[model samples]
Target: MVLNYLFRRKPEYRTRKLLCFSKEQMYEVVADIENYSSFLPFCTQSNIVDQNQSELKVKLEIGFPPIKEKYTSLVTMNKPNLILAKSCDGELFEYLETVWKFTSVPQGDPMTCIVDFSIKFKFKSNLYTHVASVFFGKLVKCLETAFINEAVRRYGRSSTCIFEMTSQD
Candidate 1:
């Protein structure tokens, strides 16, 4: 069976997408979180709360234009990648839990992987959700493009690369 979820807090305007990447790229993406956190548009800040073999706690600042607020979350990144965060813990924390699964492509390329992502939560309000969704789409696209560009600039074209996204629509 396939297990997946989508969570939102309507009036509060907080949403998250749990997307998967190939197994080969799994750890690579995780490792880049700290370095790239500041680069995300709405994310004003990200702090490493704790680190060990099993869990990672992070604090972040989410911005909607000139207004900015803080959020904190603890992720249980043990065997499976689990993102458990709350907006209440920081200056403002809301409950959000997202999980990611990595699967290998057995047929051809060594760099290939399949990812399954799931998320569950509540949104503050529908209006906030709608607005953020529209703005975030553009923001995420730009951020992803920037990420790829940064990778190319740092490593050149010859570097091993595999970037893919799966959608259920």
Candidate 2:
């Protein structure tokens, strides 16, 4: 029991934020996986190996100091509502999944939306897992900011409202 406790999988991290962009705008920002390297932190390279209307197979390489790893993920898109990406092939990860949900703010401006984002992942190496667990929250936050920044660059800032709520287990 003690060993199990010591070696438990890391908990998922989730965050909700109000953005100045519409749901469709945010969806386009996330669904553009091939452009991730341009804005996403630690992402050195991103390429779509295969792509269709509803899904894509993406190869991504991320580097963090002494650790640099490449992985392939299957990304599924549900139009302007949801985007899901799961690691399908990788030597670095035991499992990895990210979910992005976007919805129109109730009775709010049509140009505004709420984004719910979550990530759950485990590394194949114990050392990697430990290192990642320590910096997971901050890394996730940076990723979220990167996306928002990209949106601002593409569509221009619509509002100054930057409300966010985050949770990490």
Who wins the lDDT comparison? 2
Model 2 CA deviation exceeding 4 Å by range: 1-7, 165-169
* Poorest 10 consecutive residues by lDDT, candidate 2: 2-11
Clashes of 1: 19
For model 2, what is the alpha-carbon lDDT of residue 23?
A: 96
Tens-place lDDT digits, model 2, residues 1-169: 7544434657478888888899999999999888888899999899999989999999999997887889999999999999999999968788899999999989999988889999999888877777677788888889988999899989978564678856323
User: What tens-digit string does per-residue lDDT give for candidate 1 at 83-142?
Assistant: 343444623423455454455666845444554454434445444455554465465456
Off by over 4 Å in 1: 1-22, 79-93, 118-127, 133-169
Error of 2 at 109 (Å): 0.5
Per-prediction TM-score: 0.60, 0.90
